[model samples]
Target: MAAPNTSTSDLYRQWAATYDTDGNILQAVDDLQLANLLPSFVQNLRSSRPDGRLRVLDLGCGTGRNTKRLLLAPSSMPLEVTGIDTSEAMLAVALEKFPEATYHCLDPFSRSSPLPNDLRDSFDGLISTLVLEHLPSDVYFSTLVSLLVPGGRALVTNMHPDMGSRTGAGFKLGGDGVRVRGVSFAHGVQETIKAAQNAGLEILEAAREVEVDEEMIQRWKGKGLERTAQRAQKWIGVKVWYGVTVRKIGDRED
Candidate 1:
């Protein structure tokens, strides 16, 4: 089989229109997990910084789904969210949905300085869902560490490394029936942990989940995607996603 075209920005631009409605099971799982996990982090930040607004960076915030989630979450402190993505098309949809949040168009991999200097070590928390696989290891850890203040927390999620070989860690026809694929790189669990430690982040928690369940299988069957349902069934108990929470323990060198 030929490799799926992995042009990151172009592919997302083509897929942006249908991304939200794509009935993506993985995305659904991510949403649920993030919803459950984010509240505690936000609450902690709020308690620590009672006098000011909490700043958050949503890296690779495609269509702003996770960004909106963070904004909607009930918090004691106000949230100032800034979302960044390489594809203008993706950012356009996100901006439309949440005009209140700041959106930036930037190529994380190609840019020498992906974020503004003024924002360095300013964020109270950072969240990147299903985005890390697309970033180089050095860039991944360095950018994450740079954006967070010491003692700030971060949540990073990606397709499980074990499933990357099977699924290429790349995009396919999302639930919306768009035939688009973006480039992705595979990094193992140990590699991710090591990167965080090397960047002076203290790992708080790590989890892996098998997103496919009977409910998801039935939903696929209802949509008349029998093959997809079968594929989902085959992996019912197999882990397909990984999430990690780490805290910045030291100040950025720069």
Candidate 2:
């Protein structure tokens, strides 16, 4: 599949209209995994600051899918969320869906781009789903550290580099019927871990998921794309996406 050579922001702007309805199985899997892991991380944050509300930043919060999930998730303490994305079209849709949450339109990966002063080192937890692949490894790790308070936790999910190499570093129809493709970078698992360590983050958990089960196979089958479903079945045990949970341990150098 030929991927788009456009900038990430332009790609998402074009994709914004159909993103939510795109039936992306990788996104579906990531959401399920993150949902399972977030409560424990949230509980940890609440335990540390019993009197204060937990504040979260949703990086690359396209259409606020993960942002809404974080906001609606059941938690012991009060929660406030802020979302940031580079595409105005994407943010427009997100703002409409989540009017209460703060939204910013900025490129987090830009070296000159700085987060609002009030938000620096202020978040209790941060969640980024299916977004890191578009960012440089160094920028991704450094930005993650800068956005969190000391010992603040972050949950990040991305396409596994191994899988991305096989599938290429961009989007495809995948039986989802969406034609949009974005530019992406493939950062290996060790490369990400080393970047986080260099940024003074302690890795707490790392996991990879591969799904080619009957239900998943059936879903692809339903899309009427026999070739896509066959490919999925062929890569049954191969890692699809990877998730990591890390905590900031010291000051950010960048």
Candidate 3:
């Protein structure tokens, strides 16, 4: 996971206030393989624990964009959901939108602080979407397994590193003063699989899919940021979103 840079937090803070109304966030909901991603993850969780209430963790839950959607999804259960993020401004928006669930503003990657001990192994499953790309290699995979119960499951999606090869550049912050050096490193299937194995988690489902935000690309193009626009086009051309579902093992509680 990436270190929490105050700069990044502030930028995200400002973005949080209107993120949901912006073209980018709105596009992600309709663009990302969300139509399928949401339903599938919901069904999987229900299948595994059909009879009980559910505990869920929404990692990097920016302004509750994904959290709001999940909570409102008709397929989801009555959940005791917790959302964690590095941006308080974003968490503020989330808390307002989802008063029913809990929200925490913290850097999951700092390693200085781990998840609350009492909550360890307490969740039935976890869901993190479009948040992994910001994490450095070390924190990205390690923080994931640490948050789950032994038999717990996680669904995560990140910007595919393949974006670099396809468009000459991967994800980057523009006008947003976020310090993310070494943040663009992309994890392939093998690395992700290895990370899960090392963490004693087993892969249940995984794949890369296309996620294109046409309005965002056009917005960049209109702004004459040809480079970013071209890359965005390449992003649409190629499937650059990767996702995976893994279950923690080796803990007998399951």
Give the alpha carbon lDDT tens digit for every residue of 1-254 in model 1. Answer: 33456687877887788777655556756766787888876777677677777889898998999898888878866699999898899999999898889988986555655567767788888999988877777678888888788878898988776666566433445443434556777778888889888988899876555556788678667867565566566667766778888889965332
Which stretches in model 1 have alpha-carbon errors above 4 Å? 1-3, 111-114, 169-179, 215-231, 251-254
Candidates in order have lDDT scores of 0.76, 0.77, 0.66
Error of 1 at 51 (Å): 2.5
Model 3 earns a TM-score of 0.76
Score candidate 1 by lDDT: 0.76
Task: Compute each candidate's TM-score over C-alphas.
Answer: 0.85, 0.85, 0.76
Candidate 2: worst-modelled 10 consecutive residues by lDDT:
168-177
RMSD over all Cα atoms, model 2: 3.9
Choose 1 or 2, whichever is better by lDDT: 2
lDDT of 3 by residue, 112-154 (tens): 7877776566777788876665555557767877777777888
Q: What is the lDDT of residue 3 in candidate 3?
A: 32
